[model samples]
Target: MADMNFTGPEPDLNELLAARPQLGLHAQDGLCLENVPLNAIADQYGTPVWVYGAQTMRARFAALRDAFAAETVPMHIHYAVKANDHLAILNLFHEQGAGADVVSIGEFLRATKAGIAARDIVYSGVGKSEAELETALSAGIGQINAESAEEVDMISAIAARLGVVANIALRMNPDVDAGTHAKITTGLAENKFGIAAADIPALYARASGLPGVRVAGIAMHIGSQILSTEPYRHAYGKGAEMVRALREAGQSVEVLDLGGGLGIGYQDGPGLSPAAFAAMVRQATNGLGVKLMMEPGRYLVGPAGLLLASVILRKQTGKRFLVLDAAMNDLMRPAMYEAWHGILPVDAAAFQGMATPADVVGPICESADQFAKDRILPDLRPGARVALLDAGAYGAVMSSAYNARPRAAAVLVDHGGFELITRRQEPEALWDGEIVPGA
Candidate 1:
């Protein structure tokens, strides 16, 4: 598994700024994303807000698409909706001719709401309720990646009931090590993600003869935060071999849904090169003659969004602690996966302050409600703001109202200005739908 932490000294503030060109230190204003200053948004909407750069996302999508095109690799890019499900974010990708890779009906609805055609969406998940399957089928979904034999049967039954031929793909458990964090890895034998490789042959044959289903192809997702292509080379090589074997058995294989887990640099470094990744993919599946599809979540949006937080207080305990109003409920990656995110001050003056070690934490009651431990950060006084970098993916969508702290507001920056995408949640709204024993 790839270690999420830096063994040596973390990159200095300027190094971090240099790595992400979208952000910069304004001479008079503060840290700016695109053209709007981070301090400006923080001052207006308050801290614990999310700000996403529209141009950053646009550039990233173009780079990924162009890399594949450069390698002469024909593939469809499905923006993974679970990363950041905000409608504005979805619409931005859709405008760039990207489809959606959804795992639930809610996400499917969000995609369609954002003007993504139903035919462009791919539904993938292990536990799709009957209602969810029916919804996707009725709405004319592009493909459904079935993870198990029972799910295949369930899809068949629902499709037959609806009188529609559901396009399906057998998700193969290639059991390849993605070399990512263990908690996010999904393709191993012990994980409950997909059908075992040994069992795919028999199941594929059986599903081929089933009613109300068209077996389009095979799909596999090894894991998330995958920084290298070695695992993909191994996994796709197995997938291509399976495609050949299935064809020899008189089964049709049309699409290869190479599930996405492309990683980004959380620290100040180029995490993964799109050109290298594309070249490796081209070599791995060189003459497969199958329609290719990839579902990239973090790679596209992770670097485009950031969490703006304010220093609540500086506690000088056994270890220096910089507590912010934002908690684990707002950004769970650190608490959940021990993830590393670049922490930089929003003020231009503070951006160049003397570095000192401090534990960046939140007000959440949990012991794990920390973002960085002993992180070298500038001297941020109480009320000073900082931007938690690379938070566009698996950041807000995974947020909750834990500790009854209202979910933070969100903003989208573009064209030298910013707009409020989601307003701060009102605390009373937390219990609005509750039934208090008929009181």
Candidate 2:
């Protein structure tokens, strides 16, 4: 069995807030996200709500774009929709001149519905169904990143049936470890993601022959939460070599889709800076005139949002447990990835109290629903609220209706105001489509 890697020591609230400038605290307002006090949000919208900063997303997008532009690298950013599929978020990116990187038909449709042109959306996934391929081709998507030879053939047949040319990039597995968790790594040889690097050349040749396929270029995504740039240096360096070799072999490779796994500072630690990342890209793909593209998901939104939860009760049975009304069903990253998210009290007075180590848990029945264990936090009384920081990416998108717990509401905040984008799921909505036997 593979060894598990856990998060290191948690950072204090001050450090966490300092790392994320979008969040602020006030004497009277307590915690404020992008000019709107979170306590006000909790009072009006109730707890277990997701709050996102629109201005933060816009700023991050511009920062990434400017970084690549500063190095004079022709890069196109396709927002990875799977990270946060909310239409409001998608529309925000689209408004910022970003494209969409979708993995399924549903995401594809969402992107289109959010005013993103079909020509600006790239379809990528390991296991796309025939129906999905047909839909993408029919919609005239910009490109389809074929992950396997089987998928290459599948796209060919589907595009031929639709009488359209399917733009494609062969997603190559570079066999490089991204130095991230085992569950999220994709570039390794053992992972079931992209096609093997050796297999790409032959598959590219095969794809060119299909009447319905246009071989655009290559694509790769090593893993998620990648901190260091060395793995990318190795992967993109190899990718550059492959492009040169393929061009020598008479392939017209016009695009290099460097799929995104750029990490965020979840623990208030330093993350890979956009400038540093762009510098690496400049060096790795230098003089390779192909148009560069990236599919960033978390890096743009991870630090721009958080989860708001209220304390339900404080259980003291030999050990202290801070039970919250929000459970794994609302934000599953902790329960799913053993992920670390800084928890901050929503009251100014709470921060003044003495800190103690306690288990921060949720209302979920399973023991795995715990968020933090033996973590130092200030005394939080019942009815007090806390914000789970750095939860913007995989928080609400991964939520479930487990234990009949309704999914939480989502809000988008801007300059001194907030708007509820997604309403809290009604309890009856969970079984809206279910039918009793013989009813």
Candidate 3:
């Protein structure tokens, strides 16, 4: 939503959410973010936890899906498992008829466990192990997007060994820049992600000769957090061209997978709208004649959740610094990409007026753990709660307990509002497998 077309004039989270209140995600019970402060949530669910609004997830899926459905391109929304792997969130998307783009065997198992059909799950990753492959095969996964020629042959061999024909697609690099955060870009030629587009023909020829291998389609993942549709159109157009070529060469290509890099609102304008993004895909691949597939992780869940942390210490050294109990280990994007996230007091009652310019920081040893630098905030005090906005995507999914600290808990807010989803990791589990040599 915050016009990512430009670099200057960056909008923060407060401004972003205010513009798209619908995306702010309210509970089915009418619990809106504006009315419920996360501090109270932290107090109830404990600190360093994730909270999601079920209503938000459902709405996002509908908005994005409806936009693409207007055209003939059959859009398949595969929720990216890496975004936020909470089973509850995954189940919510599943109820909305969303498939999963799983990258690991564990994710595959989890998806099936949550009652998602294995036929709806698509295995996609650059570095999948033999066990992971077998797991997916045994589970009857619909298709596997092989990133390398070797993987294509290997999977075919596995499928042959198992006496089954495998559905496969080549993940091709379109050699286009997604113009997003570099940490997330996956489709560039310089990156070690997908197969190059130029070699698609040769690879198809080779794959055609492989036994028990069905080259079902082609896929292109330019990057993550893409705010523009130009890059998607470019990548999709190439995929369309490849599909045409493959069919001419007597290869059966039935699906066209456009990798998900859709970003949600992080700072303040409305985060990238799925409806707008979907329209672009429909126009680009309207008559491709193959089932259109998209794997969106962040855009579906990022706006539905928040990371609730407690203010630990407030220090001033000619500048106000508010330290929090949660650190980079809890939410790593802000430190990793220098990303922007909205910080709100847990108490909406305290937000009636402007306060002071303070840095909302975490207790991580690294100085980069700071959430916001030199941003005006309320006069935060110890024990006060602050809500980290748009944490629904990579927030808790990428979390680590690096500093010997326990992991946080997760809660779900539905019509009933705020039910515990996952319990925070306790210190006992940090050393649960440790041995003291028969002490």
Candidate 4:
């Protein structure tokens, strides 16, 4: 019930590295992700690149899986594709025995292309189009989360036309406040995410009667970057009550898709503990006897990555502005959600220097291109490099080519080395497929 807003004194470099165990600050070599120095990566890949620690991601998944296992709960983890949709990341999760939770046909296809089995993908989104639904049904995904009666009807019609039964779970809007950012909250009644909890019974009946629809269970996703389990306890409790009501009415319920929103510390703070979260799930849905599925996106990848950018130039008028080549187009969370990401110098010596307040900004024309305001960091010169910590999830995936700046490259670090997963967008490729109508 306390304010969920992130607030605290600025964490020093040691504190930042301590909170994120995957990052290490070497006395001479500088900051290293996993085992490879971030400077080495920036030197090779150039500035404004995304560097991910493969082992960190793997360990996070294991921790979550183990947490559920310890609670004696059978949980199927579907890595939320929208968080970071790079194929390499998806493939890594898939190889680790995780499924894919996707929102679009493109994501579904990307999951499959990443070697996730078609039956292991869960297609979820409020505005699924006819084409998207048809594609999902064609691929025979594990389940389609229906957000409305109209969506159920559409799925039924499409499945009937294709002569294939579509497995579905009604996404119930429990109207629970997840205590996250208002823009990211999806379970509120006003938000356009899921079906009303009151309408589920009748809609479940309708879905049962539909020829090509198979009612699997229920799903609820309150919001993203949720740092507490209280909202989930409330939402899952409501979902369990609904399942009991449905089963009492002689309807079969088998799956409970507890969509993920586990938050991570972007500022050396604690996030929702996986063990605590699993315990909440166990306590809430104890007697339900349904298979549990979680779609974790940020929790698994957020802390494992950082955005590497080089200082472009220092400008001082009334205030200091440390400009970088990266922009909001490269990492939009700050601009979009007013999010916070720890900025650390890539060089350990620089990080150890005297700290000063400055606005860390990007080359974008928009004023919102700023990464941090009045942020305290060691004085940085042009050509010096810095890393925006905890950007593995929403950073690169949400990037765009705004202001004619091409998207940055992405690299995965592991085994004392790194490999480029996505190359930096070439300037000419921006117009490769774009056409001038009159020309």
Candidate 5:
């Protein structure tokens, strides 16, 4: 495969993550991404692993929640469990009095299992299974962000079958293009996510007036990994407008969901502070007179976690490549988004050793498994440990068993103590249900 061209004005990873909140550490810490004591973990649990800071997760949630307290409209900081489904992380959010915004029944189970009450879980997804509906209703889930008119009917019908009315919310697609990566944006008119704005009113009327459903409010989640607040402004403005129209048509639109796109800085990211993003949101819905629900996936956890990998090889001569044990299967954003994630030496060897610019690639068989096509690094050897910065959100959650490589183990570090949250997967574990067709 041919090498992609790289030149001009590339961001300074060393300086950017050095100052960002989620990625920043105490001065002279000499680490980014995990910023954990890599030497300690490597000796204890080995490399190519994931670790999260529980205290950081709690702090970020509290920061976002506190920012909107002045609104007087009431709010719930629902942790989108899809980001990192570790029970420790969910339990931490629970202890902070946060709720869970789940997209699937599995996540629903995880939140509840992690001590979150069923009433605190809010389910939202485009294609939900029927069993998921029954499970939520039986579990007494607080609300459902219904994405379609059919889903509205289905939820009502499912509740009817279960003899309990399910709480519901209309996931309105204000058609606000959350200007972000194409793979993550979902609120546009044609995206297969929420229902169109034009049809939400009638759908709500049907669900609210129906016998087996409680119309709680309106919800909208445009996309994920969103860095700008402009899309949120557009979403809230348009959503509030819809809420007003619905109220005039004899509907009490009590909840307004701006949908979480508040992104953490990755790839020379200029930190997106939770407090700042929340304050911006506060200004948008200042007098909307509705309780706000934000389904944040990345912002809540992205900065709190890091993926630690060991450099396996460094090739030079032609378009240099810094190969690491972590591949596309480990963190897919690089290959998927041409994304920029600040990669740092756990030891800051680049500072003490010779400096050079080279592509940080992975050991994956494919050429696309490269993390940074041309990144500056302090000449690395095979054993030096490095980290992928701002990986707390979509990092481990998106890893796959590609190339039959066993998924890495996941851990959490809190109060300077560490615990293994998810065990390393074995190759045979992937074939848990193996059986010959003839047999």
Candidate 6:
């Protein structure tokens, strides 16, 4: 809940376009993602639609994979499914030889449905119910990152009953600050995320003696939207020390799950460099012979998608308000995380126009539904279209029907063409399962 207000000179539209190469302004097509005009999609599917660039995702995955390869680290990349759990996105990562890092059974099922083998999916969450553990164990999940001692015992009992050995890593809370938002930070001792470092040695020893549990290694995740590698170095250094301690105490360690929080540049600034991150991991855990695994969510997909919305109308009073057809129900990050996403006009002329400050908002009744405060943009008349940039992750996947607004349609742009990945939710579908009892 940091200061949400933005007070400064407007970001240059051309500069924004330059930062994200996937997007460009065309003379005839206006704003194009991977050279596909966004306005065409908005016009055909109606406004309040989501457009994702498949090529962009593929390039990002390659970049991260190659970065680790350059450092000579045998890294296993797991696509964090919670960020954007669309089957198309999951399948694309699977094709790139990436595994799935899921936190829930539904996400696990979704990853498998996308053709990701259950054995390639690693379950990580603070709370895993008995049913969920049974389901995951029944499906032969590859690895589970146990958060608490109780969870370890729970997994042990369930696995013993099923007569199967479970492969798990102790998720250690390194108490390192990731210099991110308060809500997203998970590595602190106060955060209810992982087991404390002091408890790991004893837990590892205890779990090793259990009937159906095997202590693979350790896992640690500090936070989301992390820009610096120093926090990771601190956390990973602690993890390495714990690994050594466990080994010294006669324990076998195998895999080190480096939880993902590699952030993207929300504004025009540079994001966390994969090369720098890989180098830091190398420097921190260089001598440890354990296998390296990273679960990256935002960094892989956040910049590859956008929300296309049409201007409902422009209101002017003491403050200029630009109302959009898309509401908080469509993209909640702006209201939920107070996140900043670059907004650009779909028309080339509008992009070149003189900018003025206006409060960009959705039609939701709540005041918190505002997307941007005092954002500078061109005079977008009614029916004008705009694209909210860097919304590929934590955008549509987090959407809801709070105001009874049906979810928006989704299109995937690839190979110089676009196709509907998810059709817009019909209005009647909202209440399809509801019942007016005793009417």
Looking at model 6, the pairs that clash are none
Task: Write model 3 residue lDDT over 189-221, tens digit each, in one string.
Answer: 999988988888899888877887888889878
Assess the local accuracy of residue 189 in candidate 6 as a C-alpha lDDT between 0 and 100: 93
Instruction: List candidate 3 segments past 4 Å from native.
Output: 1-17, 20-40
- Each candidate structure's TM-score, on Cα atoms with residue i matched to residue i, is 0.98, 0.98, 0.93, 0.98, 0.92, 0.98
Q: Which stretches of candidate 4 lie over 4 Å from their true place?
A: 1-4
Write candidate 5's Cα lDDT for 1-439 as tens digits. Answer: 1111122465564575555554443345556333456556666777788978877777777777777774443677788888888888889889999889898999999999999999998898899988899999998999888888888888888899889988788888878776677788888888998888888888878788887888978898888766667777778878878888899999888888666777765644444665567677777777778888877778778777778899898788777878899899999877887777767777744555666678888888998898886666787888988877768887787899999888998888866667788888877898888898997
lDDT of 5: 0.78
lDDT of 4 by residue, 96-152 (tens): 999999999999999999999989999999999999999889888889999999999
Which lDDT values do the candidates have, in the order given?
0.92, 0.91, 0.79, 0.92, 0.78, 0.92
Judged by whole-model lDDT over C-alpha atoms, candidate 1 comes out at 0.92
Residue 156, model 3: Cα distance from true site in angstroms: 1.6
Candidates by lDDT, descending order: 1, 6, 4, 2, 3, 5
Q: Residues 54-157, candidate 1: write the lDDT tens digits.
A: 99999999999999999999989999999999999999999999999999999999999999999999999999999999999999999999999999999999
68-183: candidate 6 lDDT, tens digit per residue: 99999999999999999999999999999999999999999999999999899999999999999999999999999999999999999999999998999999999999988787
> Higher-lDDT candidate among 2 and 6?
6
Model 6 TM-score (2 dp)? 0.98
Cα error of candidate 6 at position 320, Å: 0.7
Off by over 4 Å in 6: 1-10
Which model, 1 or 5, shows the larger TM-score?
1
The deviation in Å at residue 422 for candidate 5 is: 2.0
- Candidate 3 lDDT score relative to the true structure: 0.79
